[model samples]
Target: MIALPFLKSAPPPLQGERLYLRPPQLSDYKAWATLRAQSRDFLVPWEPLWAVDDLERSAFRHRIRHYDEEAAAGTAYPFFLFRNTDSRLIGGITLGNIRRGVGQNGMIGYWVGEPFAGQGYMYEALRLIIPYAFTKLRLHRLEAACIPSNERSIRLLEKAGFQKEGLLRSYLKINGMWQNHLLFSLIEDDRWR
Candidate 1:
């Protein structure tokens, strides 16, 4: 078996013309909860639920613990995407479910603030994250799965150069129901070698 390399506590914060992606923190709680809760309807179809607990600082503290552990183990990078120039936490994007060794891959997941949707922020976050995953973390592939009807998400992945590999039937349980997702991925060294 290949020995696991020590993981970085955090990836260097990423920047773009308008946005930056950084590790989550307790200070981000209020903004994160507000945005996510306000976007409940928009996010519900895509996510599980807006647990009352998810809106609490105590819950966020627990979440940060899990996030920090995942970071140390090199298994995940759950980022809060912000608009740097404005200092606004617009949404979240996570490089989750990472696997090392011969696979060297991770999955991408994200959501944009309700009001911030259609402004290309999700695209910007994805653009920054894909390269970060493949180049900095040396991951071999970046994968994303979207509900076939989630046009915005599918569009973002395609714009970032992920190709559809297949459709999974009842691949994941979302909002308490088994749902389908169209799987997409980009192999490293293919576009950014």
Candidate 2:
């Protein structure tokens, strides 16, 4: 059995030039809900089935608690992306399903608000998270999967140095249905050299 790593505390916020990545907090419910509501149509196709009360404040609080627990257990690290200047919640990113023994790997997932899409915000966030995953989390490989048609996401991952690995048939349920995804990966040794 794989033993979970432990972290004494939550990771500190990752700061960037124009954006910052931090775990969701109780105080962020309003902004998170608002952005999600507005971007529902834009984001649904790439995500899982949303619960009826997914945007409710109570639900968000529950999510925060769950994320905190996951982080402390070193099973996952989830972050909300925000604009540094105005502190607006723009999107979210997560490094999940961490495996440490043989693989030392984790998977990454992310989404941007409709208005924030195509503006390079997510790319900058990736730059921050990649290093943290390798240097701080000590992960050796980072993987990402996106629907084959998500050209924008493919481009972003490529820009961030993830190589297209292959196609995953019926890999995940997206928008309530099974979907194929293109796999991409980056290794720690290839990160800086």
Candidate 3:
């Protein structure tokens, strides 16, 4: 796989005031499964339909392998968010669909366990990943999309300085149906503004 210069090595764990982000691992299955099970109802509406074996150990192993491949190919960086105080897994974030050359862009996607929602963990995760995407990965723009009805995501994107671009018609098949999504973006030059 061709590697971008900036992604020649796996990213170091990103540290923040209340949490840190690291890649998924085999040892994380139990915590990950428990969290997802608890948050299934909370997350399902905003996500693609989950496979019957989505939380099974074997499926998680496949997910880890896929994450490894995406990272190796410099197409995406996926991280699991963990609280600092007790080292509990709180959520996850990804900078995916990376475009190189003139585009120099990527898409951001995230999810937080229900118990950890509305607590600013996702915001901090964004704070860490945005700079990493801009400086370390040299992305010129970062984009995110969410279902229009997802007020929480809309607020989070705005708070993180992403400007609403427009609506995408049936952009993603979420929850087993094609759903309209609002697109938001933050350019590298917009970071400090």
Backbone clashes per model, in order?
0, 0, 0
lDDT of 1 by residue, 28-108 (tens): 998988888888888889997557677788988999999998998889999998997788999988999998877889999
**lDDT scores in order:** 0.87, 0.92, 0.94
lDDT accuracy of residue 10 in candidate 2: 79
Alpha carbon lDDT at 42, candidate 2 = 100
Q: Lowest summed lDDT over 10 consecutive residues: which window, candidate 3?
A: 1-10
Q: Which candidate should be chosen as best, given lDDT against the real structure?
A: 3
In model 2, which regions exceed 4 Å deviation? 1-6
TM-score of each candidate structure, all chains considered together: 0.94, 0.95, 0.97
By lDDT, rank the candidates, best first: 3, 2, 1
Q: Which candidate model has the greater TM-score, 1 or 2? A: 2
Candidate 3 lDDT (Cα, 0 to 1): 0.94
Q: Which stretches of candidate 1 lie over 4 Å from their true place?
A: 1-6
